[model samples]
Target chain A: MIDLPHSDGGHLSLTVKVWRQDDADSPGAFQTYKIDDINPEMSFLEMLDCLNEQLIQEDKEPIAFDHDCREGICGTCGVMINGMAHGPLPNTTTCQLRMRQFKNGDTLVLEPWRAKGFPIVRDLVCDRSAFDRIQQAGGYISVGVGSAPDANSVAVPKKIADAAMNSAACIGCGACVASCKNAAAHLFTAAKVSHLSLLPQGSAERKDRARKMVAQMDEEGFGACSNTNECQAACPANIKVTDIARLNREYAYASLGTSD
Target chain B: MGALRRLLMSSIGKKYVMGLSGLLLIGFVATHLAGNLLIFSGSEAYNTYAAKLHDLGALLYLAEAGLLALFVVHVLYAYWLVAENRASRGDEGYEIGYRSKQRTTYLNLAPRSWMAISGTIVLGFLIWHLIDMRFGLRDNVDPTFERYVDEGLQSEDGRPLFLRYERAIQILQTPVSFVLYAVGSILLGFHLSHGASSWFRSVGLETHGLGGPLKKLGVILAVVIGLGFASIPIYVWVAGVEVGDLSAAEARERARHVSEQALNQPVEAMTAEDVAPAGSPDSDAGD
Candidate 1:
């Protein structure tokens, strides 16, 4: 007997409308799928895997999606389910989103992140290399460790370390971009800027890092922040707009030619 | 010049300009509302304020020039910023627009996505207001106000002389001007509902416990300014307080009474010229 999470001991059927695009240049459309016999215990990704397996059995092309560890740490898997980033589960990745939130007869619409900087690669996958380019631009500390240091060599204040750790939790997922009204990269960029600028080790290049990264972000065709905090609301990492405030502080000081 | 160029070219630098300009404009509107509210005190107080402002001559013009410059800078930068932002979002938007988590949705929310549309309406209304209220050769004005202009107690130099309180009340009660001002104030309220608080965050003023309170403050401020400004027109229209109903003669009587009270003269002893205001220029054109 098959397992079911319902009292009826029957299958859960769902109507899923998934975006299908051939490549970056090709136009895309929504293709509907009628999925039945789904176990309510399956994660959202597992449900997608079941559908892909069914497609393979029918001699059709399996849908392409990006994921590494199904545990949601790699920041690889993401999709818009019913217009919400990461499938309507607040601060939870798509891989971790349980199918229980949805009912059996529900219809889900899945699409990739939409932004000029993020063009669709195939179905439910877009190029986020723009983020890497921004990170490389200056979202780094120039100081070298020269091997391991003693435990007491660096003593970060508890308050400051807590702030840094909070901002450093950003997973570079494009949810911030996906849910932003302007598709701006303020949250992601601010997270990196705040994480490094809060620490003593990153003080040397802090000013230039803020300046270069902001410039690179603008160059990548990302929009400006209107400060709606939509990104903060949609983020899986729970990154706050206070981090953006810190980035603004850093950018202002950098523009003013101030040193640490 | 190099430093100025860098400030203008960068995204954050432009935002700093936007925030500063927007805040200054808020200051202007607040003071303007204070002065405009003097109409409730009766004709004499309002006219004295207007006459004194007009007599400031060059200093008043200088302040007006500065305000216009701020407005121009705010509008121009907004234009460029919006254009670049639209270009970045690509030709296609999400079939569904942005919606955030509703936990903090108890906060007074303005449609942050509709800033450009609301701002455009406010701009149009401002231009129409200048034409309707400031410039002469207009329609449906207070009869005594037309006499003041003819008597050279006021000039047609675009200075609004609320010499008779009816001058303001009458204009507000007009069919077109009333709707225009009402819509303008409402859209300005919409703009400020989100923008009033967002400017600080743009300028990096966020701290612990500040965001929520500032958002609440923005909503309160917007309601007071926008709805408060719109209410006067609504009041006049509803009251049907028109000018032709003993208004012109009443303006004259009030002017005479005010001047006599200031000079402490008897009604029988007071001359006709005593009704002319101290700050008002004598007749250059006769009615």
Candidate 2:
């Protein structure tokens, strides 16, 4: 990740309201931190680093947060800022959110992604491993990579590949969970269903994948989709709600044990 | 009997009860409005119309009883269905259930889902309506049927209470009441927009060539009901005329002032982020 140079003497100050929780099943509360002289060009994560450094200097426990790769691809840096997922920029991840985007004296309200499945871990951090568990339930191809047939030999249709790519665009950020009125994981589950269901190699386990993923999704205490589409708007990848409808159809058909 | 029991227990069946009872209540409103409009022709016409209904005797009583049963069934079913839906959703913030078995699939139609949300809002407005108009001040007749039947009048301290029409006019003359009625009617319009057509589809009435006409009828009914209900407050506001014996011009001015205030009130915009507070218990903090 490129660290842009700070302009105008590297001085930026703002108030941040962050959610703090010690562990799962523990009560949480908001803690306000007054950050001063922050670098305007620094990414949102880097700004958090500056605050943590100050805390460490003061001999206090630094705020715990999550980030990996400092790139948008990892989907690890998820935060709700001033009521929006990944700050104000549409389709932008928190890692890409720069301090320059915010003005001086602006109050930033930060929180973890709210959902029944995602329990609070600590300050600004959540246990998104529920998503990982759901994915592990049936989100992969059973075919061996080395012994696999050639790409062209499989003969995938252009439309199928395009659809698969759309589903594959999902980074599993859980914005859908935070945005949804029911905190449903339909978008994530549907994207996974559509991704593998569209591909030829994954067809063998298609029914099992749908069943297992949906069952696991429910087991995680995620709400059912009332088709609010807030998830679609909040999604960084802009995953269509149509994919959710497709997931419903797939589940319905799969439950009947028929492809048609 | 078993099939009837199943129908009563199902979600669609509860919706059917609501629709059917709603239609019945709409019919009552149309008849009541037609009767009330006679007041413009003078008290004799209005009183005679009331007397004619009273003269029906046992038949009128039976009809009243039937309407009461319908209202009870509608209210009970609505409460039960909403409770069931809430229970099914559990702790989840929202619930999206499969409606594949239902004849008219909301999955295929975008507007249908929008209507469902609007319907919930309208339902809320209706509850307030029943409290305000039916059970509260509008029913000038005492809750006890004995006083209404014996004297053929609204009783107050052992005397025949005059100015039944005046009481209604006073209630309607309030700006807050007028605005509430207007807003409530608008919600009703939205409810009927989706509901009218869905009702026919529910009962299998939209078959063959009847679908087009039935849909048109639905739209017409929605508009007519919305306008009919809205006109009560609008007429009082526009005419600025007091009914019966209440001739308080000051009250009329006060009503107009309130109406203006209600009209001028600014509507607050609700954004997604504004719904839940930052770092609140419900909000997710990225860990």
Candidate 3:
């Protein structure tokens, strides 16, 4: 047999089962496609681009997915890869995932975030405006409109600052909701709530923020936290479930009519 | 009062209720298991405990009402929450299990996910337990046990003590009740494995250092409770070799049969010759 350049382990064949839906009202199902001679060095999104190109040449409707920045930062790229949020790697975004991680002849299943709070927009895109609404409900600290205060004006302990920053690392990608069995958004809401509340700047309305955001989250039809911690496992930011515990404390205080 | 209503109605509030009520139920189950363990202590002890409970009269009725209210609230709230949670994932769930799974379609195969199924089994077991043990329905419990009467074996209030033990043995000895109770106890353990520890997290009692250890402890408690209750029916089946609480001759016969069983012989088929005749080949020589 004649030797081909594919002998370098640079090529792989894969079967992809991707969810396809035209619009919000349409029912979706997994459509399987076989791709050959893939470059393993390609990012997962680039592999998808190859699949779309192949589909175009085959006179079929190409798959629809969302991506921006082609990096892990934007949080624009996300889908359930074999039911895992942001593919199989821990602390990874879909755009940052390389095709080399998967083996040849492996089958991968992809789907949009499945939750009432993040309804499907198309093939692999879902509406995450519920997060925006929750943020609007309270997830912000109000500041007086003037020249910014000096950086050292408010004394924040180094440890507390680090904690706040850690909580603030959440990208609001909706993976936590997709990964949750209950489709609960507790992680996303809790991250924001914790990020603000841990800092003194957010103490003025900390309790109020917790109550309002949680109420909005409930109104969005997201389910309650069952303390499963699948959201913690699935988060790309590696946010802890302790943030959720903190939110619980804040809400309790607020409901008990604590004036701060 | 208005705040209370809203707290009970909100998502976190509803979770608080579920966890609080669930912990309360766990308490009741532990107490019940403790009481049930007195069965091994013989008629006088078990009956004395039962009589003490009965003597409470008005206090017992009041406690029972509270238990019933808690049960009703816990069950109804659970069903409603399940429905609500199921809907939150939209009409369709994930078509495949995640990376660690073997391509199964069910999205979650974790122990916590199966809580409802285990809970349902526990409910069935509870009803059966009440019917056979508490109410002593003639159809459900073997009425044959009522005939195993003895003289002068009465509680402080003259309630027949031997009949209670015999009645329990009669009921638990059957294949149906045995399977029901045994399976129910195991499944209840499975349910509590998740529910017991999760209540801590739900009510905000879980902390970083304590959460992991708390989980292991909860599972251990759950498993122990399960095995403890199941042991009773197993004891009945073992002690049931003779007619439970019967003539002394039958007890002697049972002891002889047990000794023969240790030799692995069919008790009836074993003539004296079959059991190591001097000239016969030693079948158990190596052992």
Candidate 4:
């Protein structure tokens, strides 16, 4: 006898079209899976789990996808659903997208994030390590944690604090990369610049931060921001293009005398 | 140095040129639109207005020279900025994200950045306009003196001038021109919709105390300018004047003759000679 409950459910049936790839550079195809008797309260990722469970019962190979920190903070779970990053909910991450948002008999299309710099790993999984490389290029402050002066030493204005907080909200999601026509990473780089450059802690390395981040962004094969502002719309974090503009200003100033 | 370096090396300079030249061009558009609106007053009034501008002589020459310089600088600086931006990003593409949460709550909900796309379309329409009206139609100037002359104007000599109002009427009467004008006008409206607001923001005129009112004013100005400019071609086409059937070459020859007649007329006859020059050297002098 099947241990799974047949129906605790309000009626919801969904058809999911998921991309399946064995490895990077490998050919990929879409596989259809039917999910039935889903609860309205369950999250969209939960719905995927239900499908995966059914597939496992049949001894079929389970689909591979990325997710961690089911809450929205990690930026780990990003997938394009029906041509939109993070599904239909504006500024809501994939894990936060609840099945209650959809009606019965809905069809969901899922695919890995698309960008020249972000290659697919397997199935719906993609290698987002490019963002890491770019971050490492100089996303952080140079000051050692304990080596820094007293926090009260620098008197940062309230407006700067608010702006820095805004920039600090970026979660490093690659939705911006997937949505952009040019696949520009300006939004991401901008967030990094704004967060650090706005804070007193990050003042010493401000110029280097802008220069290194932009250089790393270019090296990663991302495109330039055309000021389309689409990425600003798709971001779950709701990061602004103003941050990008600030980044541009910082980069401009840095390039004047910097050797690199 | 490369184009990128050249542009960056003179970033502030380019911005000054863009801002100044852009303001000057805006003034020209305003004056040009005001003059064209007189067409609604019947052919005689409009024609006289055209003749007046022609009689300005030295003043008119100065205005044209200023407009030409503004146009050249604006185009050059625009191209330079675009090229430098592209180079800075290099081959790698930039990522853009929609900050739907923040924008909806914190910032103005309107997708104002979409104006760039609208501006590009308007630019294409402007090119078509130059070709059709300025070059192909040769409607703006009387062929006689090479001075800018409005069609349907009388020669300062009091001789009955053969204006190309017939051609203007016929061109406007065509379904193609009417449709083109309508579509172009809509694009222009969209371009101006965001442009007026952006211009204020660029110049640091959008302060918290005045930003809201300024934006509202910008919208009103955009709508007025867009509709006003767009209405000219539309009104001419719809007026249904009985244009005698003239071949394209015949039309050109006739326009040329009318232009010569208007140009040779004495400086005293044109009302434009009486007015002060349209622009001030002191305005753009800061750049």
Q: Best DockQ goes to which candidate?
A: 1
- Per-residue alpha-carbon lDDT of candidate 3 for residues A1-260, written as tens digits (9 for 90 to 100): 11112224668899999999999999888899999988988888999999999999999999999899887877788988877888777778898878877888888899998999888899999999999999999988785535767888878999889888988999889888988878999999989998998887788888889889988999999998878787887777888888887888788888889545
Candidate 1 overall Cα lDDT vs. reference?
Answer: 0.77
Q: State the displacement of the C-alpha of residue A213, model 2, in Å, after optimal TM-score superposition.
A: 2.3
> What is each model's TM-score for chain A?
0.94, 0.91, 0.93, 0.92
TM of chain B, each: 0.79, 0.59, 0.75, 0.64
Per-model TM against the reference: 0.88, 0.58, 0.85, 0.70
Better model by TM-score, 1 or 2?
1
Q: Candidate 2 lDDT, tens digit per residue, B1-287?
A: 65455444433345556667767776775676677666556433443454345446589879979987886786676566555444433332211222121234345353344554566666677676666544454444232222322333322123222222444455667777789777777667656655666555443233335655766787787788777777777887888856543223322222222222322211122234433356643233211
Tens-place lDDT digits, model 4, residues A201-239:
787788788777777776677765544466877889988
List the TM-score for candidate 2's chain B. Answer: 0.59
Off by over 4 Å in 3: A1-8, A143-153, A258-260, B98-109, B138-140, B144-163, B241-287
Q: What is the lDDT of residue B267 in candidate 2?
A: 14
Maximum-lDDT candidate: 3
RMSD of each: 5.4, 18.1, 11.0, 9.6
True contacts kept of each: 0.53, 0.01, 0.57, 0.04
Model 1: residue A66 alpha-carbon error in angstroms: 1.5
List residue ranges in candidate 1 displaced over 4 A: A1-10, A145-147, A258-260, B104-109, B136-144, B151-164, B245-287
Evaluated on chain A only, model 2 obtains a TM-score of: 0.91
- Say which prediction, candidate 2 or candidate 3, comes out ahead on DockQ: 3
Evaluate all candidate structures by whole-model CA lDDT and list the values in order.
0.77, 0.64, 0.78, 0.66
